[model samples]
Target chain A: MSRPKRQLMMGNQACVQGALRAGLRFYAGYPITPSTEVTEGCARELPKTGGRFLQMEDEIGAISAVVGASVAGVKAMTATSGPGYSLMVENIGYAYMIEAPCVIVNVQRGGPSTGLPTKTSQSDTMQTRWGPHGDYTAIAVAPSTVADTVTETIRAFNLAERFRTPVTILLDEVIGHMQEMISLPEPGEYQVVDRVKPTCPPEEYEPYGSTDNFVNPMPAYGDGYRWYATGLTHDAMGFPTNRPDEIVVNLDKLRRKIEDFRDEICKVRADWMDDAEFALVSYGSVSRTALLATKLAREAGVKVGCLQLQTVWPFPLAQLRELLQDCTAVIVAELNMGQIVREVERVAPPQARVHSLLRYDGEILTPIQFLEKIEEVRS
Target chain B: MTTTAESVAEQRRSDVHLSYLRPHKKFPNLWCPGCGNGIVMSSLVRAIDKLGLPRDEVALVSGIGCSSRMPVYLDFQALHTTHGRALAFATGVKFARPDLKVIVITGDGDALSIGGNHLIHACRRNIDITTILINNYIYGMTGGQVSPTTPSGAYATTTPFGNTEKHFEPCDLAKGAGATFVARTTVYHTPQMDRVLADAIAHHGFSFVEVLSNCHTYFGRLNRLGSATALLQMFKEKTTSVGKTEESANGKIPIGVLHRDLETTELCDEYQKIVDSLSKGKQG
Candidate 1:
């Protein structure tokens, strides 16, 4: 392996680098603040590698194009902020229905409707899983630091291709714009997964045929296996169908592909959790503050630890319950109006106390504020 | 032993069917009987047959509409995407695999009302994809709602009082949006529709063909336009050749290729040029 090189880079720029390393060859996106850098980086760099980048008319078109490219046998991605993410909900659902593998990055800004373009928020945590209407499984990952952003983006694409589903990377404005020194991974340092292709001849190939693992072999367009793909509920042949049995089988495949492989799909980082009274749960940028807060709390003789979630969706419930079993209380710190805190409360042991430390006023949660919340919850 | 004109025409029709259509998918299509969409589909299939292009190399993409269902009956790499997003998806397919012939089949509302942004932008980019927009003047699949192409004073379910919105001239809109090739034809004129679709598919840049199809189940019944056959006959009488520049009496609509620009660079080619220069610059 080549030596890793240390470079100063923005988190968004690192994401672009990670995408390139993960075999992404097509990028389609529109400019949205806090995430525009990702698009700009791809535009400048993708062509040099013989990959293509398109600045579509809107977020909807951007994601639609990404889905198309993915179906056409290219690893594809798009980046957007809150407003743009909202616009992409329908096509995201379409991707899920059609089982297209692509990565979507939401560098979240505060929003009900373009609420804060330049400020940071983790308000889209729930949106990442539930934004698209219907019964389907979703995978979203969060990265707290610039280095983690690259690694997590690579993981996102791998999971997307392996599972044949859309994967989202949730970044806040803080993580997106913050500059940090990071050691870029050498080639082969991380795993890269491409979708499985069909071994059968063109006549016998089924695009959505089920295997022992839920994912079917995906044939690229013009691969002589010219099968159908649709957003409508479809059969194993990828043709639209309204039959109850076929619909149930199709929807069940989508859910089970990720759910059954939760252990392999979910990633979390634990700090000082072996012997602790208070456990702090956080993700994305807030995890940085939580880490500092845990350090300060330990300095003050308050036995506290942090659980930094890297994979936000697939919930990682089993892991959370196991880790929080010995702790007396768990504090969920996030830069939103208590989104993932509810998940913490739902999964924590019956004896463990659950409290939320939320900051939705367009400001990052400081370590001091986290300490105060810990004190309040402890008392 | 001589063949009559009718017999020769019948023989050609069967040949086109055998060559272009999927044999296993039997005849009664999803469209309502006498729906002009079937005629448009046949014309499209005939166009492909005439070009002698490999079926496996072509991709048919569509959004949700009665007209959009045309792809399931034919044999090609097909994508039935979300409502009103066929062009956007088709853009991706074309960009990724420029060698594959991508054709989009969309209807009035699917192309104009909800998917209008993608339509105009696709035209502006002049991407190398053939788009056949079937303008039935109303939303048929949704049961006769007024659409952007529904003529003013025409009646639809949503426009029971009368449609107050002016209809769009699709060919003009495509030309204004920078489509390299634009044309208009009626489903009644089968030979013209087939010829125009072939030319559009053969164009090296973005091409648009607006087929004035009849939604006999919705638009016709609402407007009291008689039977589907009567409406088709009306199309033949009320439309003038685009070559006849003089306005026919009673405001006859023009039918035929309205615009063509063979010199404009296609989007895919332009993108490739950028990639080439960037790669060369890196090496030098």
Candidate 2:
């Protein structure tokens, strides 16, 4: 009934705000630079809402705790930087295999291994999808601004709960620490999805029962479901199975649950190229650079547009291919050394040429930088 | 649903522990025929059966090992997790759902080696979860590799010449890590293990029970320990109950509840108090 409050908050702070808004009841994480604020925020806020927060000894424990908490029927989350994210890949794979819904926020820093802690880099772009081993798909949401971080985080939880899979909120150091004014959404402004519980009685309930959509309702521990969860490939009853037929069924559900409905899962922000000749494709804070560059290109009569990716994983190639259909030249600008550019090259129309604007010095990509790359590739 | 009431009664009378096991799960278990892990698992089942905890209200969590396989056969809300990380997961389960009883089954390598960090931290927090560390002195599942509990001069697949590192006593490690309740027993002492486990579950804080089980197939074959019976005899001769005059003087392993501190607040309860106080503060 009343207008929502507007306040200046860091991107990490907004993430905590968004997680709490989405009914996060459990958080477990270890401290990492550029993402420590997220852990601190949850620690201070979770107990206030009667939710539990824990600072596990290390990243493995942090990720493990989140999966454990999620199984016990709480909306759970964890945040970390590149090093911690590396420690979490194994359990992220575990979470995928068991089909536990949770959110992981990687406020990415420069890295092969801890390249730069305080500086910004999107080097972990590919790691977000492929870090966890085996056959599975991941849903990732990338927010370019502080305010967008809040909504994207809520969406991350929603996607995780919707498909019953772990979703990643990928941010770089620039956005994670950057402060901006965010008008917090009132209740009913943005939808919050709670975990899906089985309607069937505890006895008849099959935790991994097949459905047309490939998603089965999840029941929390101690709710009389007495369901089993294992990292091993499991059958319909949630017990481990090594049979070829059963393993295929277990692996297929993970891929199809998100892939079959990617139209609902992927989000992108595209602008300024109704009849443009050149385009800039980017995500995270680089999209902010791409937006400014497109505006500058338009004023300079350079006929360039920008496509900002809000969701990076599952590639969003189909949507991107459609967006770039009219363009002759595309510049994929990012802080990493051409991570997302590789994906753009695959989707660029056969007649179109995809150019890369890369930065790996742990710094932001500037508008002038993206514009220069566009002009060079155009000529 | 097909199980008849008369058949259920027959099963309960024949083997009470089988009634607690999952009807659909592959049972008789995957442990080797003469494995000490089987005895250890049955003791756990008996302990839970005696405690009268509801099946739906208890969660069995385990890491990868011969001992970790215990959860697969249980009727409880079971979680078969990665190698060496069951305690970390169990901490989350218990912390999030404090009303549910959480138990962790791990082995020497799973708990003390790969998962050592989680084990120590779980003890330090004193969360209301019970951990059963089944020490077989070698990595049985991985085919008898030397483990943290393997003696300095013991033989294993990797330690063909003999193990060179000093062995770890699991109970000592638990106590050092600030576990609120610590106990040690062997498969040979089934009654003591059953009693110790039930008490450990009843304890209001983190309870660590070290179970010295024999890996007759691996550790025994590699070293010259003979049959499962010989290993059981060795346990009887090697261990004595805590605080017995003549037995204590025999320089044997102490088999009993070694340490218990009831005064310290558990992790979940303290966290609840914080949550309660905050809500009260808001109201006032």
Candidate 3:
């Protein structure tokens, strides 16, 4: 008498299940195509879980409301597509500087301002990194499958809480709306990280003080500790300052905190790269086609492999360097105008050639299309 | 504990300077001398002190502007965010922890201008939080530009020829937007402001306060109220609190508890109740 085995679910539904499992008690969002399903699923499920769901007036309000909810000390999230993601940049910057822990899901769509609302694109890859002004680092995870969507959403929540930073689940339209069979892991199977709580007396705790761990403990409101947080350059006490050296040191620390612990932050999957002449570098739904293309290429004796990225930002360059060092060339396949391909070219060895296979009209690349690029790059 | 009216008054006069004020005087204070933001900041600190909310459990959020800088001077967890979105950040802060007492100190420019949508929806949704909007009738941070509250005839940087645009009566706006607790007070009216703020904090729903402040440098110079004291005098002269049953007339906006409709449901509580029922369903 086994409990119900794995069930078929849409990528958005899986994300909702992930939010529930991760203890996401609040969700604020505006509905847009491709990403609307995530909001719809949350709307139906959050109330059942005693979790809150709000359809804000617009994307800015949605993210803002989530930020407000976050400070009140609940696990909160919001979902949107590319255009909505653009509107959320200001609040995202606020979350970054204030060290507010929350999750945002962007079901990527073709954009430069609503290029194709219903189409898929990875154009937001660079936007997610540089959309907001000012100096800050972001943590974004790209999921390749419906199972990955669920797990990665949970991981995004955990990473956001642990780091006291906003984390983005970089999904595309193809994966977000795709219906797929996935086994839901038991509730206890995955590690769920909660934000660090203040253990010291309110008088002694500085909101941004760095101990050996480089992360400060956060105290939720009404707990009696009074601390200050601001977007401006501040000292350990969270008061604004104009010191140049202090600004430099604080900015450096913000970057180093993530990079210093890169091993814990980065994630990538490799398949059949031991004796490969060509490698297909891909992420999100595009990684699926690359994997299938690799299987076909290998069967055709082309010796191709796939490097699937899970943590897209802080782009696992070191792992990439080691993985592609011996390969003759790397073909990057994505649903956008070759964003990550540039990153691959930048990080790949000087001797290894880099090529991009882009699809911008809101369509997913099929195995044939990916194999064509791999074969062309190999020749 | 419920706070008493007497204690609220005592809180206002209480020495809150040590907790918030910079140890040494910093120059180039943006507010006009004797402007209400300092008083409002003091009132906020005193209210937090009176309630004895754990400092760490409190996160003060503000958007860009003169009043938004209130977070910078406070000792509590604060986020000085972008223009017009303090409510949004405070929303994030509150939803993330729910245990945290989140306070948003925003201004007319930050709240009603760029942040107007966030403000309206936050009130409508009725989340349990407090928003202190300092209404100085002009954008003080950006050299006293016209704001949503600037009187139609008022002059501002953007309205050099006198504003012909309509002004938003904040108290009415909050009440109409379904805020559970809405109040208005001038900084000169310190006792009432402190008491009302504390009540707003304890109200269990979205609480909004329009602290009619003086923008002597901007709104004042244009409107012929030349000094901060003169502006305070004007606030005293213009405002009169209508008791609970009285209908507020045009040009007679009340100075206290404009509306206190407790019937509106709080979003998180409703959400939690649903979770409780579901978990019970699972157990049964």
Candidate 4:
């Protein structure tokens, strides 16, 4: 790749760049604090790429439109914050059931309901995966910095198209609004995945037909594959089914299709994990501080390492378990009240003393805080 | 695609309207016998047939309701979405491919109460999607509850003490929200409904057609309105249509096209202009 275009830009603007580079042709979103920049950016940039952008009346309408566009075989996305994300959870479940490919960006602000509007909060960690009521699986990615936001967004689109499911990019106010200097990815720098199209003739095309990869090909609406899509449990023929056997097959496929490729879907990056006795685990903006703590702790003659979890919901359990297997103590740094720390507890070695460095005061955790947690665990 | 029923296939050869339906999926449909939903469905299918739009280019989006079940029985790009969200989804489909004829099938509660915000904004945007709001006055699929359109003093399950709420005139809402084409027709008026719906679909911007359907099982029985046939007869007597009238409908729910503004810009066409201007800007 001829050296990626180096420039400085805000995180939300980079996300739009990534989405446009991945060939997103349709976008519908509502403005919500901390995430409104994403919506505003799409409105400004989408038309430049010959894509259509709409500001919906609410988050429900925005996400509903996004799902509709995806079902119509267009790469689509929407962005919002806490209250809006809650409103969208209903349609998010519908998107999951219908197996539509789209990306949803949630630049989190604090909330059970309209918490801090301008501050960063990772309080929506579990909500992103379980917000929608159902047994359907979810794939979500968390990017730590402004530059990586571009690549992570492209990856989110790829994963959504690959699994034929709606994927989420969990950003917080800090990363979403933070400005950074970096080069944009060159046009062939990253692989882009488009929605799979039917290779068979229209007459034989089954919208939910089982293929070798488990994801059935989906065709654009006007492409002559006039198949059915519904929020109800549907059979392989794309028709709603009450038959227990067909219903089980329908629901099971959603979970199995993504889980089968778990190893490929889950991404965890390890730093200095060769022989560390103390490990710090984190993701998104929190991971940046976690990594800094690991470095400072090493200089201070303490053997500490950091594991950044890029893929939040396929949980990355096996990788976390293996990397933390040798550690005597594990510290989980999060901007929430111990959300992913529970995941760390599940995988930490039995002898490993797990500690949670929690902060949910509408502010991000610092490296000193992580360092303090490790020191406290030692005492 | 589902397997075709042989009998259904045989019936298609006998009737041109049968060709518009799905091969076998929910062949008989789930609506009760003599339900007005069937009549509206027939009228909608006939209008689509008259338009000669290819099934491939047609997308029927519906929310959850008895009336919203219209899409599953038809052979097109059918999407049965969440309750009260059909228009929102159809907006996406229309903007994504303005070439595709996107039509939203919704009911009174689905369109007015829970989905009311979307409907108002959709009309305001003047998006190119034909919305058919089937007003049965009560929620038929769910046990008869007091929907937003349940007439004042009408009895519903939730309104067993008789309704204390005023009702909504759907055509008025459509016109007030800036829909380019707005119409009201009863299921009893099939010829009027078919022609009105066809004209609405032909209109360039957002089109809303209110179909006054009968829910004899709950709405009619609870109100002591006699049988489904009696409700159909009532529609014939209660409504008056004189094409476009500025006068108060003389206390009648006026039928036929209530409002039409063909010159108003459609959302899709305007978006296309923006897209064209940008591409041209890039070239220049």
> Which candidate achieves the best lDDT against the true structure?
1
**Of the candidates shown, which would achieve the greatest DockQ relative to the real structure?**
2
Query: Candidate 1 at B223: error in angstroms?
Result: 0.9
Q: Per-residue lDDT for B35-58 in model 4, tens only?
A: 998888888888988888887999
Query: What are the lDDT scores of the predictions, listed in order?
Result: 0.91, 0.91, 0.82, 0.90
DockQ, Cα level, model 1: 0.75
Q: Summarize candidate 2's per-residue lDDT along B122-146 as a digit string, tens digits.
A: 9999999999999989999889999
Can you write out model 3's per-residue Cα lDDT over B46-133, one digit (the tens) per residue?
7777787766666778889888887766666666777887787677666556666778889888888898888888888798889999
Candidate 4 or 1, higher lDDT = 1
lDDT score of model 4? 0.90
C-alpha root-mean-square deviation, candidate 1: 1.8
Docking level for model 1: medium
Best first by lDDT, ranked: 1, 2, 4, 3
Error of 2 at A320 (Å): 1.0
Off by over 4 Å in 4: A1-4, B1-14, B243-250
- Extract clashing residue pairs from model 2: none
Q: State the lDDT at A126 in candidate 4.
A: 96
DockQ of each candidate relative to the true complex: 0.75, 0.80, 0.52, 0.77
